[model samples]
Target: MEFTPVTHVLFDMDGLILNTENLYTVAFQNIVSKYGKDYTFELKLKLMGSQTHETANTIVKELDLPMTPEEFIIESKKQFELLFPDTEVLPGAKRLIEHLHNKNFPIGLATSSSEESYHLKIDKHHQALFSLFPYKTFGSSDPNVKRGKPYPDIFLVAANKFPENPKPEQCLVFEDAVNGVKAAKAAGMQVVMVPDQRLDKRMTTDATLVLNSLEDFKPEIFGLPPFDD
Candidate 1:
């Protein structure tokens, strides 16, 4: 396969760079179980990479829960506060980010998380690693974004923030959700997906490339600087 050299790198935060998906599962399960329902992988696949309100509404409707989206958000925020403080950086995330940063690649974060929850995930354990990004676009809170994954708004907004305002094709996105890959592709960028093990293989078709983990990424394949072993 031929690869084009990309000038900018964009990342999806939740399941991609951070291990917050496990915490999210615990939180969602705690909520749904209270209503005698289990949070299943089918629902997770649909909700991944969606904005906060979108996720809340989907969960409430899909599970036939009694609570409104507002109430669900309130309850989930409580669980997140308790669990997200323990968010761990995923494998190869730091090493790759550092390698790219050291090589002077323009890196940015485009996440479906709201500003409030974004801080909850990163404020304690990941401040330094995330600080590598010169800018981060929070889809749930950023008015300019207007939409989340499966829409190109967030990725387009992030690409515009770069000093040079790179074109969409000049950006290389790293994502871990079907919706995220869709969003990046819609924005006309190439995306590398590192999907969850439970996700259906067929769902990853839109991604320019798919890998099992960030540890398996080869920057040179995308025309980025190679890591010095």
Candidate 2:
């Protein structure tokens, strides 16, 4: 698809940049399994890109668990600290980010993770990569973000944080969740989705481009400088 003259880019963290989604799956399964509940992929899709409270509430309600949202949060946080720091950068993620940053593109992170969570997940392993982002909209706790993905709050906030305050049409978003695609569209931005193979193909129509991994991305297609091989 032809893209606009995009000048800014925003990224989603969990499954998009880092491999922490798998860690989350393991943690959720371990916790819910204690209550004889199974954490299914369908349920995981529904919670993707959601805030901490929303995720916890959905888990407790959907699985008929005995735990409260607070309980889930506390339990999950413990598992996260033990697992998140060990996550690896997903394929092509580091290359793409470094390329864009080296080219002086305006890029930021827009994630449902709070500042505390972001640090817990990334600081030990990927601080250099994150340092490239001048702006970050942490939806889980950023007060300026009154809502989360599928609501346009986080993406809009990220776009607005650019020093030039880029127009929505001039921004592009990289995401790995269905809700994230919806949010980017709602915010009037182009989205490139690198979704899980298990995700339904029908759900990807909203994305301007859908690729198996960041390695498959073509910068020139989005009006960005082509990567030199």
Candidate 3:
């Protein structure tokens, strides 16, 4: 029940740290719409936290779209970049990062996004926001070659980065997607779900803590004061 006991924190980038899920949704819909298929919000939610090719294949099969997975990925990435040229960190993200960094806790970013796309979304400004974190794990960087989200590969990779003797139970994962929660749970880590626009009832049940936003998180939850100053 207590969260402050966590030693390391792992974060999911897109919907969790950066508020870009909507942009992804818009891009997906725009691309699919050109082929006469409707990519509803409900459908987009199903694709959340999935790998680019996986999501594209899902859409292709579901809508019987004509494009190949590779084409879908290429076009979708282009559209997303154009639509979201600027990125913004979610509320409380900077504060939480600073708080954890001040306490010398190791931080990791575990995202299903490709390294190139991830870098594009997180430009120079966004990098400064997360400059304190010492570790990162990307879907493109992992070698296990397993499915993303709803699967534990990404989280497992990040968790393994801790000192060789670290216990899995001591790590905490911050996620914003249902699949991300599932991944963390499968990885045997305590998870906090900070819901963005896509969170639903089913996703909340799997989380150790389901919060409306990171704004409500405080260091005291980990037995520390609100701020050092």
Candidate 4:
């Protein structure tokens, strides 16, 4: 599909910019292991881009874990505390963000992470990197975001936060989850999906483009400034 030149960029946090997806996978594995259940890739994909409550319930129902959502949350919290503090930035993520920042592009973060969870996900090592984005919509807790990904609420809210309030068509979103791609499309924006290798390519066919990693993204194709060679 063809797309117009984009003036604004919105990025998803977990799997797109950071290696939190791996961390999350480990946490989920640690949780399910206690019950002798495997937190398979398919299950991880379903939980990807989901909100806190949504993830808990999905885990309980899908895994048949004998625990309430709240209990799941409590158990998961233990693992999160240990794993989330030292996440690595995805390859090329810093370069891309810095390129956009230097060009003075209107950029923002539209993530499913709640405010509290956001802190855990962005430790001091990552705080400086993320601060480059002037606006961020933490969907799990933002009042203006009535719905999370797979809906347009967070994307719309992030887009509107730009000083120029660019139209949805003028926004380009970078995501690593199917629900996030759907959310951007629902908001009338073009999306580039850099999904997990375990996720089938067919699952991301709806995206404007799909790549194995952020390192493979080509800025000029989307009308953004290309990186220094």
Candidate 5:
């Protein structure tokens, strides 16, 4: 299969860069269990890559919980604040990011997280790794991004932030969620997906390329600089 050459790369932060999916699962479970609801992987697949308020709304509606989305957000934020600081960089995430940065490739972050939650996840742990990104779009917080993933707004917003303002076809998105892959494709960009193993194989069909992990990626195939190590 031939891969199109790409000029800039945009990344999703949660499962792609940080091993925080489990932490989110823990947090979500903690909240939903109060209502005697089970937070299942199927629900997680549907919710991944959604903005903060969107996620709370989905969970409230999906589980028929006894709280408003606002109340759910308040509870979720309490859990996130306590849990997110323990976030760890995923395997191969730092290596690939540093490789792209050292090669002078323009890379940006586009996360569904609000700025407050984003900092809670990365500030104390992976700040330096994330600092390599010159541009970052916090979908839940950026008024310019009116919609989140599955809408393409965040990826489109991120690509526009590049100094040269590349066309959608010139940007490559790296994501770990089906919603993100759909968003990237809808934005007319190619996406490399490194999804969780539990994700249904059928859900991965929209990705331009799918990998087991970022460590398995070869930048040269996408016309980027090859890794020295």
Candidate 6:
């Protein structure tokens, strides 16, 4: 099937590019479980793609935990680092980013993670991957903190950084969760949902395209010729 050409592409960092979402889930569950509260996988799915603070608050309320959002965030981050000392990039993620870089496509990262957390999760090698892109926008850098995922501020910030010609509508966003997809759509950009195994069923609808994995993604699908076979 023919696909619409994209002038720019925006990527979500955590789940879309890195396989850190499950690690996060484990971290949250571990911490919450100690308080005699369970952080189920379904709950993790519900909170995926949200800002750390927002998610922490939700967990606090859901599990009746005795911690403030700030406290929970600090504890969760510590646990996440312990649980996932070595971050793993998703399948085909590095290749896809390199391919886009080689083609000089304007690339950007729009995620609900804080800049510090983003860097911690991405580290040096992944930061090198980011250097290949001309522009980037992180959730912490968003001017409107009140509006994060499911609000389009982050994606809009990234899209606006591109040259004035193509506009947001001409850009494409690759998201791995419902909130990210909503944010991308709210920005008026075409969205491709690369749903993770842990994603909820509700997250699957109304996406411009849905695929099981990035392994199936071909450059030709984005109106670029496939570089391999």
> Each candidate's TM vs. the true structure?
0.98, 0.98, 0.91, 0.95, 0.98, 0.91
The true-structure Cα RMSD of candidate 3 reads 2.0
Error of 5 at 227 (Å): 0.4
Task: Mark the 10 consecutive residues where model 4 has the least summed lDDT.
Answer: 42-51
> For model 6, how does the per-residue alpha-carbon lDDT over 1-229 read when each residue is reduced to its tens digit?
4567877888888888888888887788888888888888778767877877779889999999998988998898798667554788888788888988887777887778887777777674476876786766767546654576888888877777777656777888988888888888888888888997756566688588888888778677777547664
List, residue by residue over 1-229, the lDDT tens digit for candidate 2. Answer: 4678799999999999998888889999999988888999999998999998899999999998997999999999998888888889999999999999999988999999988999998788789999988898899999888877798999988888888998999999999999999999999999999999999899999999999999999898888989999
The model with the greater TM-score, 2 or 3, is 2
Clashes of each: 0, 0, 1, 0, 0, 0
Q: lDDT per prediction?
A: 0.93, 0.91, 0.79, 0.89, 0.93, 0.79
Q: Which candidate, 3 or 5, would have the higher TM-score against the true structure?
A: 5
Better model by TM-score: candidate 5 vs candidate 6 = 5
16, model 1: CA deviation in Å?
0.7
Error of 1 at 154 (Å): 0.7
Off by over 4 Å in 3: 1-4, 222-226
lDDT of 3 by residue, 1-229 (tens): 7564766778898888887887887788888888788888677768778887788889888888888888888898789778665878888888888887887767888888887787788775587766676777777546663788988888878877777535677778889888888888998888888876545677589988888888877656754446664
Please give the lDDT score at residue 112 for candidate 3.
Answer: 88
Cα lDDT over the full model 5: 0.93
RMSD of each: 0.8, 0.9, 2.0, 1.4, 0.7, 2.0
User: Native-vs-model 6 lDDT?
Assistant: 0.79
Model 2 C-alpha lDDT versus the unseen true structure: 0.91
lDDT of 1 by residue, 1-229 (tens): 7778999999999989999988899999999999899999888888888999999999999899999999999999999999998889899899999999999999999999999999999898889988899989999999998877899999999999999999999999999999999999999999999999988799899989999989999999989999999
Off by over 4 Å in 5: none
Off by over 4 Å in 2: none
Inter-residue clash pairs, candidate 5: none
